[model samples]
Target: MTSSQVFLSIALPFAIIPLVLFTSSKKIMGEFKIKTWVKWLAWIATVILVALNIYLILQTVGILK
Candidate 1:
């Protein structure tokens, strides 16, 4: 795969997962924790990214046409 695709399909999910987790953690952010709406948005975005990554893996493995 191309470098950009590798970054988008792999590295981005890894980076965003931690960001979502950290931002949503009460212990991590204390009083500055992300708002409910923002947290939901981040979670939704993370889910989408994860789903896309799964699709990419399936395609690479020839499970997807």
Candidate 2:
């Protein structure tokens, strides 16, 4: 895979998943935990990123156009 694709599929998820989980975890962030709206937004973004990564994988595998 290309370097950019590798970064997006692997590195980006590694960074984003922890960021979303940590920011949303009250136990981790305490009073500084992300607000509800921001948490939802982050979750939505994470979902979109995951979807895009799946699409990229499919494309790389010739399952997608």
Candidate 3:
């Protein structure tokens, strides 16, 4: 993987985590709760991150090109 991919792999999730927490937090989800759309988007993003992490590890180990 190139430097940019490596940077994104680390940065993207690091970036999204705070938003996820904020959106799902008790303070925000208490009264006017998180919308279905937001939840689905978060879930999809999380899945993508998991897949990317797996791919990056495999590439690091010479299992992927």
Could you say which candidate leads in lDDT? Answer: 2
| TM accuracy, model 2 | 0.81
lDDT of 2 at 17: 86
lDDT of 1 by residue, 1-65 (tens): 66587557877777898998998899999999999999999999889879989888778767998
Model 3 per-residue lDDT tens digits across residues 1-65: 58787777767777777777778766866865677788788878887887888689678768999
What's the number of clashes in each of the models?
A: 0, 0, 0
Of 2 and 3, the candidate ranking higher by TM-score: 2
- State the lDDT at 33 in candidate 3: 61
- Candidate 2 lDDT at 3 equals 66
The C-alpha lDDT values of all candidates are 0.85, 0.87, 0.77
Candidate 3 wrongly placed segments (more than 4 Å)? 28-33
lDDT of the structure predicted as candidate 2: 0.87
Per-residue lDDT of candidate 2, residues 1-65 (tens digit): 78687566966788898999998899999999999999999989998998898888888878999
> For every candidate structure, what is the RMSD over all alpha carbons to the true structure, in angstroms?
2.0, 1.7, 2.9
